[model samples]
Target: MMLRIPLNLGLLLLLCAGGATALAPAEATGAPCGGLWARCLESKCCATPELTCYEKDHRYAQCRPTGNCRPGFHHEDPVQTPWSCVVLTSPAPAPGPGPAPPPAAPAPPAPAPAPAPAPAPGPAPAPAPPPPPQQCVDKGQHCVDWAMAGECEKNAAYMHEFCMKSCNLCGNLFTNSEEGTAAAPAAAGDGSSNHAAGSSNAIDSSLRGGR
Candidate 1:
């Protein structure tokens, strides 16, 4: 069975629902220096009865004393100052409810997975090849020449060691003897000569069964 309510009653129900949604009961306009008032003071300038003016954003201002005012004091105002300066008509009772609590902040999201482990250490470096015999021989010659040029003791020692090793390997021992001295100069003056001598010595030493 279909039951139809009176049009007036239906309309009244709708109006009631709309009124509930659209109009919240008048909350107390709140203390004069309440939320909106505080915000307004924060956003604009205000003056106190003492004929002092200051920026609302700064919170307080110095008020110069008039004939009937306090001198050098902070004042908060809702509107433009000087003209707006007026004694409070009546003390506003302390507000029953404090400022509405600020909205709760949202929680932070979890961090993403850490990046994959870095690639494994690269392969071990290749072993270096042995230096050429000729290069070693050349180093020895440079050492000897530097010594003969009156270089420092340390340099002389190094050169002596280098040349001896180079010459010995090629079966030509470097000594203070006449042969060693002559050979040292020849090796320094021309590397080709040292190589030729080293080659000949190597063959001769081999034939003579030398170390």
Candidate 2:
């Protein structure tokens, strides 16, 4: 019974030590900050009322008064963390589990990636070289030359007829000037031959009458 009493007492003291470690100061002998845990801070030069136990790191860290917090003289907007240095202005209890912080505001939908600018319009491609001129098909040199001189555009039907006839004629197309010159000389020669034949016939007729 005496042995069990002492063992129970030793277990109680061990549990007490573990609980004290949680609220223990950073300068407490063997206690070190681990994981997301931090040890309480003890006021060295500052008073307990003017100071707060903010565990800055695994090691006991000192923070000078920044004068941002009135009368408190510490960071006015202090970051909340396990080991943040803070001033005891009010109780300013640890933040509790509340809303999840709104999921970072959805990142603004990535801005839709702006469409690529359209290419600048170039000169209309030289009108496709005018489709090779329909009159050029199966046409002779003269016909092609006349058509290119815009004659075919002036009268397409007339030029098309002319092209068919001229291409078939190949090279025998007689112009008006050549026909007129040849006809004048041939008509004069025919008249002269008829006159000469008539004079000879008259001479033979007189000779036969005398016989």
Candidate 3:
């Protein structure tokens, strides 16, 4: 069983227990209390004697000087804690007891976390093929025509390397003998361009066209 106490009686008992007066009811009726400068023990009331109960803490309070206290001085004003200044009179007997409080309700469980989403679908990129090697070959009859017509000026980067004999870019590939100069251009040019679809014409005719 639990001990239940009424608010007013509880307050009177609390005040009396702290060093204040004994009669909460009489104090409520505005009765005069002990002389000024007296501790608020039996006479909970301080009357109008220019004094109030100077409370030190929750468990201590006494009648201290009031009005006429010099302003701006900390010690002048005696009232301390914001707790009640008026102590109660006699204690009121409380009822025996009541049923013990019901057992506390248990707390609810926490919620579960949400699941993460799956990754997006797709194929990964493939690696790039390597570049072909640079080889010397005029490529075709067009190299000579392109050189003569100044196609070398418009497409100099390609024309200069491949058409070196006809465009006169690289020094002579064959000896300066008349036969070497005469025979080299036609043979090398015809043998290679069809050998590869790319710029270098690096592959041999045997592998490309089964010649």
How does each model score on lDDT?
Answer: 0.48, 0.49, 0.57
Least well predicted 10-residue stretch by lDDT in candidate 2: 31-40
Q: Pick the candidate with the highest lDDT.
A: 3
Cα lDDT of model 1 by residue, 1-211, tens digit: 2345677778999999988766533321231232212322322222333332322224333233333343233355344434333332222334578889999998898899999999999999999998866633545436445654434244546654565443333443346466775566566657756777999999998989964
**TM-score-based ranking, best first?**
3, 2, 1
Give each model's clash number.
0, 1, 7
Which 10-residue window in model 1 sums to the lowest lDDT? 28-37
Return the lDDT, model 1, position 100: 92
- Backbone clashes counted, model 3: 7
Backbone clashes in model 2: 1
Candidate 2 structure quality by residue, lDDT tens digits, 38-120: 22334322322333334355455443333322322345335433434444223323456887766665556666888999999
TM-score of 2: 0.18
| Runs off by more than 4 Å, candidate 2 | 1-99, 113-173, 176-211
Q: Who is ahead in TM-score, 1 or 3?
A: 3
Pairs clashing in candidate 1?
Answer: none
In candidate 1, which residue ranges exceed 4 Å CA deviation?
1-108, 135-169, 172-211
Query: Where is model 3 poorest over a 10-residue stretch in terms of lDDT?
Result: 67-76
Q: Which candidate has the top score in TM-score?
A: 3
